[model samples]
Target: MKQKELQIGNLTLRRPIFQGGMGVGVSLGGLAGAVAAAGGAGAISAAQIGFREPDFDTNTVEANLRAMGKELQKARGRAEGGVVGFNIMVAMQHYADYVKQAVKLGADFIVSGAGLPVDLPEYAAGSNVKLAPIVSTEKSAGVILKYWARKFERVPDFLVIEGPKAGGHLGFTGEQLTSFDEAAYGEEVKRIIAKVREYEARFQKKIPVVLGGGISGMEKAARAFALGADAIQAATRFVTTEECDADPRYKQAYLDAREEDILLIKSPVGLPGRAIRNVFADRVMSGERIAPERCRGCIKGCRPTEIPYCITEALIRAVKGDRENGLLFCGADAWKAERIETVQQVVDDLLG
Candidate 1:
């Protein structure tokens, strides 16, 4: 099969594979740059992107923004001007700040999700950086498009359709995620594509659509392309790559996992997320006693009293290499990855 290039605004990706953004220092300089260098779109997760810098937690917003700029510049240098972007979650405490930081850092694009990015266009005005939103359903896409159209009179440069099987904090409930019909999503994809096309026609430009979540291999990528996707975004497969920013032990966990080990677990952020079953998850599920300490206040609507544990602390521990205490977010087939490989090899396999 011949590979097709994906064009998003002024940026052109030779490979239709996009390395899905993972947060808290997972997809930073090494992995993101390597993927971009290999002709794929490399996205840096801006969720706590300043964690690598000293005094990251206590720094002011401007200082943290500077740190993000430095890291993004490092990635740009590594990619030699390849496509590089930042993934900023709308649900994050400082979403607008991060978006402005990414733009100031010369990011080629910005992908926002986890909530409706209704105000994204306002922040992106006068910037060349392409804007994209991750949507799970056609209704969600319509809402964002309508808001952007009415408020900013602008449409997204591209769109990413995330499915139920994606890693990290999911948009669907545990029951819906497990029971939702995959066949039904096909129609949903077509419907969203039609909505995007409506704007594309109005604007007289092409708006590429990328499908994300649980897309691991060329076969799946092909299916997505056939179903109206111009590209596919993958995250878990990148975790096992040599250039991944995650700790070696974290990669090993994915390699050592089995199909059964990947399950949908309750998130402290008031969402159901898919993660690898570990001791932490077991303890939480078994009604074991757990307490929420000082609230980081990361998510907007978190109920510390009712939630079992703090998500920020758990993910921070995982990124810091404390495997036993961290929540390892992964796709549905995370257990299928049996070994570690280079970023290029992973891209090649997906492009094959």
Candidate 2:
């Protein structure tokens, strides 16, 4: 296959891969910057990004906001002028503030989801920062695009159509996942692309569609592109890379997993997340409840008592190398990762 660049609005990336933003410090400057250095668009996650800060436990929001600039600067510094962006979820408090901060710090784009980012353009208004929304179905794609067009008289720079096999906080319901049909979903992706083209033609700008979810390698990316995707955004494949910010033990967990070890877990954010089944997951699934010492205020409606467990703490534990008791997020095909490789190698394999 001949490789191509992903042109989103005015920004151009030689590699069509967009590194999906894994949270709690998974895809920080090191991983994101390396991807950009390898000619792909690297993404830094804004979820509890400041967990490493000393005062993060006491001052969650402030620490997170403060760390945003530092992380973005670090990523930009290492990107070598390649495309770099942030992934800020809509469920975050003051989501617009995060968006504006990214634009203020001169980010190239913002990929948002975890809920529809209806007001995304409001904060990005008058700025050159491109905005892209992650969607699973055509209805959501229509809702956001239509709202943006009606309110801001604008359209997205690009769209990420993530399918059911994605890891960590999926957009589909359990019922939907059980009944998921690829041929039907492919038609859905096509429907969303048609809608995006409608806006693209209206604004006389291109809205490249980057499809994700279980896009494990070259063959999957090729299939998605054949289904109308202009680019690909992969998260799990990057987790096992040498440049990825995950702890070595955490990466090893992916290497050790089998097909049956992959399981669906519930998130505090009220979404189904795909992860490798471990001691922690077993405890949760068997009705064992654990309390968190403090609330990071990471999710929209997260009240510690009513939830399964503190997602922030679990993800933090996983990223810091605690595997047995930590939540290990991975794509459905993560068991296919047999060894650690470089970001360049992963890119080459997918686009080679």
Candidate 3:
């Protein structure tokens, strides 16, 4: 099959691929810009995006909000007019404000997940920024689309299906992730697409569906297209790319990973995630809990004293190359990374 461009409203991405948003300094403007310049849509993760800002420790909110615009600017500088957007999680403590800020900064699109972004339209009101809600199952998709239609009289510009094999915080239960059945999941994807089509028909507009999670290469991408996806989102595959915003050591971890090294972990936010097994993860899995030294108030309803470990700090450490002490969130196929390739090379390999 020939490569197709992903279309959302009037926007066009030369390659039907999305560089999935990795967080805590992972997918930043540099990486996103490179992907967009390479012909695919690029997404900058808004999770703790301002960690590198000097005032982050003192004025976390301000620093993060400030960083958002700066990151968008950086991406635009390198996007070459290609599609570039932000991936903001609904579970964020300042989710509403983040959405509002993103629109104010003129983000081309905003893809939200980590919870049902039911009020996303409201937050992005009066803006031309396209919106997308990330969902893993048909129920969530139906609920979001129906709610948006009833409440906002609109449908999403696009939809992202974060499959069970995705990294970081997942939408699936531990049981579901452990007992994943590809054929069964493919049926789920079909149902979700069908549900989106219902809204598309009602609104008389196209709503592209993008599939992600464990999209390691062309074969998996082909499966996603077979499942009715208009595009594929890949995070882990991008992590090993030279343009990725992560430190060299972070890329090294992916290169060194083996099939047995990746494991499913329970995140502090009460969600199951995939990561590379290491000392930090092993310690936590052994029933040892460490209190966060400081609270950035990143996630909603998260109590610093009650969680297993500080996700922000751990991810920061990982991005800075402290592999043994930080969280190494990655897709199930992280072990397959053989070397650090350029963003253009990876995109061509996957979309060609």
Candidate 4:
């Protein structure tokens, strides 16, 4: 089967693949730019993106906003004007600011998830920058599309459906993830596409649906396309790529991982996450409370003193190569990575 181009609003990608955004330096300007240059859409994560900034420790918001601009510029520099955007999570504090900043930076699009981004259109008002919300189920898709239409009189330019096998903060509950059925989820994907079509008909526009989660290679990508997905998003596959912003050790973790090494873990932000089993994860699973020495003020409504651990710190460590202590968030297919490759190579292999 020949691969088709992915059109999100006015932007056209040569490949129907999106490099899923990974936070805390995992997928930064380098990786995003490479993917975009490879003819796929590239997404830079906005989760504490300024951890490397000089003032990040003291002035969190300002530093992050500054870094966001710099990262976008870097991605654009490497992208050669390819489709580059930011993946800003709604669960983070100052979500509106991030959206506005990305728009002001001339981002091609913005993909918001980790929560229903009901206020996304409002935040991105008066801009041509495409807006998309990530949903994990048909019900969530319905709620978002309905609410957006009733309130904003608009629908998303595209929709990203992240399934249970996705890494990091998943949208499913532990029970749901445990009881997940692929066939049922495939049906759900069809229903979500139907929901999008309803909005498309009402608004007289096209809305592309992107399927993500457990998309390891060509087989998985074919399955997603067969399920009516206009595009497929894969983060784990990108992690092992040479262009990935993560440290070499981070990539090694994925290569060395076995099927049983990846497990579902609880995050401090009231969400279940998937990650490679490590000492830090094991400790958390053993009921050990790893308190945050100082707060990064990343998550919304998160009280540092009450949370089990600081996600920002853990992820930063992971990206920097401290495998023993870092939270190595990864998809179920993380174990399938055998070697590091280039962004173009991975994109070609998956889309072919």
Find the number of clashing residue pairs for candidate 1. 0
Stretches of model 4 off by over 4 angstroms after superposition: none
Per-residue lDDT tens digits for candidate 4, residues 1-352, read 5687877767999988888999999888999999999999999999999999999999999999999999989999997869999999999999899999999999999999999999999999999999999999889999999999999999999999999999999999999999999999999999999999989999999999999999998998999999999999999999998899999999999999999999999889789999999999999999899988799889997888988899999999999999989999999889999999999999989998
Better of 1 and 2 by TM-score: 2
Compose the digit string of candidate 1's lDDT tens values, residues 1-352.
Answer: 5577877867889888788999877898788999999899999988777666676656635545776777787788889968989988999887888898888778888999989888888887799999999999999999998888888888899899999889998888777887978789888889999999999898788889999888888888788888899988999999998999999988988998999898888876667888888898889789764676556556778787887887777887888787878889999989889888998898888877
- lDDT of every model, 2 decimals: 0.85, 0.89, 0.92, 0.93
Weakest ten-residue segment in model 3 by summed lDDT: 1-10
Task: Predict model 3's lDDT versus the native.
Answer: 0.92
- Can you give the TM-score per candidate against the true fold? 0.96, 0.98, 0.99, 0.99
Q: For model 4, what is the alpha-carbon lDDT of residue 168?
A: 91
Q: List the residue pairs that clash in candidate 1.
A: none
Residue pairs in clash, model 3? none
lDDT of 2: 0.89
- Candidate 4 minimal-lDDT segment of 10 residues: 1-10
Candidate 1 residue-wise lDDT at 272: 83
lDDT of 2 by residue, 1-352 (tens): 7578877767788988999999988999889999998899999999889999999999887788889888877877888788999999998877877888888888888999999998888888888998999999989999998998999888888998889999888999988886888889989988999999999889998889999999998998888889888888899999999988889999999999999999998887668889999999999999888888777777877787788799989999999999999999989999999999999999999888
